[model samples]
Target chain A: MRRRSVVVVGAGPAGLAAADTALAAGADVTLVDSAERPGGQYHRMLPDAYGARAPEAVQHGYRSFERRVRRVLDHPRCSWWAGAEVWALERRDPGGAAPAAPAPSCPPPKVHVLAPAPGGGPRRRHVLEPDALVLATGAHDRVLPFPGWDLPGVCTAGAAQALAKGERVVVGDRVVVAGTGPFLLPVAVSLLEAGSTVVEVVEAGARARVARGWLGRPWELGAQAGKAGELLALTGVLARHRVPYRFGRAVVAARGDGRVEEVVTAAVRADWSVVPGTERAAAVDVVCVGHGFTPRLELPVAAGCALRPGPRGTSEVYVDVDDDQATSSPGVYACGEITGVAGAPAARTEGALAGWLAAGGAPRAGAVRALRRRRDQGRAFARRLAHAHPVGAAWPGWLRPDTVVCRCEETDYATVCAAAQDPTATEARAAKLATRAGLGPCQGRVCGPTIAELRHRHGTGQPPAGPTDPGSHHRPLAQPIRLGELARPPAPPAPDRPDLAHLPPEESGS
Target chain B: MSPRLVPARDDSVRRTDHPLTVTVDGEPVPGIAGQTLAGVLLAAGRTAWRTAGSGAPRGVFCGIGVCFDCLVTVNGERDVRACTRRAHDGDAVTTQSRRSGDPGDARAGERP
Candidate 1:
């Protein structure tokens, strides 16, 4: 095996495993994370808490992941940088694309990172130079607006779970977890396990089946069904506690004063539209809602990597290495939710394949045929989970005109639509007069789709949809650098461009 | 219960109590104090915002300002991100299909 140095950003599932695989394959590895330890958002750890609080299936997976994280941390050849946040990344040669072949052994691509000490004082900046880069910056929950969505008690399901898991704090005793997709079940179970009263799981998907849902021809369906049964059994604890699980329903409004006091539930149609007569109101203290997750591609996009739309509504990076996992960006590889939300077990297998490929250990030539079959079987199985529940078109019915849609600026649907149409011509000259979207702190992550959908209703073309151009980000400061930070200089402007500089290094040699 | 879509003119703010008026898509409509343009329009029963290129029904999704689904030209400015801005009296609103070019049209906070 050949030896090389690689940098893996994010200490999550893919990041830690990639480093371990690279090190085992004889490459020196540097692992960096914005947190004090590994275990990204999904396997969040409590500050004063101990062990995993999830059910047996998740705990078993967590143990394996934790074991790997520990092993990688202990590796002699591995360098770990905790509490490091990467602000940007620019090519050494600047512009264009990642190199097709390895460069002459001079200095590898440098990674600039910002690390704030644990006790909390001044933040320190550090750089890591490596031959290859692996980005696994995980994902965040997708929040849709509702009447009381902005209320103090209303947070994304992920945020609520994080608070409960990481801080040993619960949002409220009575919580209604609403929305669609497999994530809801796990989040609901987690909340229930934490002793919260889960009044109802308002899923947009119906309980009735369209057809006899088959596992598939090859027959791993039995195992998946078993897993689903186990999760159902755990969630059943809600019933024993007399908690209600309302299928084919969604939360239309969450009404309260400073916090959530009541939630209105509506029966949904096939397209996930709210039925006229099925609206029902129930009192509740806390409401956790999320549609799904958009795979985070900020780091990858910042690096100028190409992305394509995934089966899920979000965009994902395009990888050339078949099912084994390798990205089109040379030497760079990724897996897990970073590529797509394929769950833990699928991620484990994909990560293993990526590690093997990254180390120059190609599988047997003929094995491709069999590998393809296995991958197909697994992907087919994964699809069942993917389509189990989806945030439907009717989700917007919950939003009252005054409900704040964009959290950054507190813009609501009324203001946004007014600006889009320019009724009085006051906002007539706003940028991109046509679509009238893409305005806000997040650019358009929260409201772009809604804008496009509305446009469609008005007989306008679809909103120009695609991943936001990540490469357009140009910032002088990497992090929230204070005035004092600028005063100190680690070194007087070296000839080389700083790590993550959008410009190519000034000093380059053939 | 389905989420309640509050009427623009609530019982507390009936026309007899305090009648208000606002312009939507160039037409004058009855409005109420403290009501948003969206609430006013929904109460008036106008479904379309900006026409999709193919002309489809697009409305609010992710009600929070994040979705950007309710964008329109409230005044002369072309690309006003609707979700973030508030509607004022006499404000002009027009349907938008797509950005028409000038990166810096107006709406300083609006991103191209």
Candidate 2:
């Protein structure tokens, strides 16, 4: 029998684990990632050109991660497509020129890829139709809007860390790292390692609330000993560096002439509403703010996967998946942060399970059971995380009327408020059209969740489409493709993969 | 903000000293081979390369490819993400802006 072909989009921990297990299960796998290296942002690898003697210095669990990378990438059945971006996924209609007899319950979507050509040449597009697809597209930093956030020297904490870890470059001489969650500790450490003087680390969640969230389930914390130890080490480094960690505080505004010269931090209540007369300004060259993470949902949503509200009361949404990590759309599986904001361990377990099942591994396998239990623990951790570091419903109160809400369009808070108040702009789409908030080049990746929550809280515009609707995340084109590239025909499939030849002639570009 | 490269001794991770240069806005900015355009620009004490529609200066907001805030024109290709695009020697990069009269301006650059 021909091997079950699996195409895993995203070479992060989840995607890499998926590819590794699928190949181990005797399936042909194609692993693709937009980055030049296999590690997604989690293990963001320094460029091979860097030729670092001690590459593990900036990374965690490097030895294990390196072993996994070699196991998957060196496997003969696995094809690694580095620096390749999946521009779109076209759902294959069952009736349209598909193979007859034993039709797949869920035919995998046709993957449209703009494969990077060697030596910086123009990219050549290739189309693939795999038997199964796994999306581990992961997430990005979701920064809530604030006054002067549009300033040049302000950036998300992830951005600061990426530069520090990937490029060994500091964002500025003096920096303030402010956000919610334990992720802030690592970001601060990365900046410090890269030679930045971190003046302070501000967390929005009050210490009492965060303690309650974590301490409520004491026994469950044992499962996350590794994560806790990591955080403890990070805090130790911060202490050594003499960086102040402040709780119940957030950067409410940034101010500067041309770039950020100072950040205004304010104490906040449990719900993140700023306390009056608690504002304090600190002189700093850069301010890094990240409320939490927003999942990269374009691919999953495009694949027609159903979404559910993340955690409980938060406005975040995640791909809905079953015990086997199978999404609503058959032949499609989702893992990693796209499913929920569980860290790398959970993502890896979920990916392993999804990969095994997608490769036609038996459901009752011993390994499958272990993966399920671990994934469940990860979900519990995710719930505790959400409870501890919830994005305050009152964060919108931090926004001034003139604050730029959409960085791309320069749509301000006042404009969005007016649009919500206008009866003519009833639906979310209408408000978007009127205010031009999420219609910019980013297509609302950065500001979609913020806008949705804002409208929902205002209680004036059209109610959210559904309980799980994360408005404005849906975009036909997942990544930017030049018109010239779109107009051109795709290159013929590579001869090594017989599966591509099975695609209909029209789709194979034969 | 003076963004500088971490000295090799101080940096936790050691890096190869491969040198490269990219001309940004008619000025040659020196950088390492593996460094991105944004890395080079930030190291050169330059921020706010692009401008918003209101002519507000902008640079490196997300430092990832998602935000598109670090966009710059590379070798006549428009809207290349400076944060993600590796800086190559001799690459001519012109900062982009949404302000009127900028080269990216549709009406200003359109050919009849």
Best model per lDDT = 2
The TM-scores, one per candidate, come to 0.68, 0.95
lDDT digits (tens) for residues A361-440 of candidate 1 = 55654544444454454455555655555456555665666766554345666665555455433222242243333433
lDDT per residue, candidate 2, B20-95, as tens digits?
Answer: 8889878888998888899989988887898888889999988879999888899999989998988888999998
The Cα error of candidate 1 at residue A121, in Å, is 3.4
Tens digits of per-residue lDDT for model 2 on A44-131?
9888878888999999999999999999998988888888899898877554332333234868788998877656577867888899
The C-alpha RMSD in Å for every predicted model, in order, reads 14.4, 3.0
Instruction: Chain B TM-score per candidate, please.
Output: 0.61, 0.88
User: Local distance difference test, per candidate?
Assistant: 0.54, 0.86
True-structure lDDT of candidate 1: 0.54
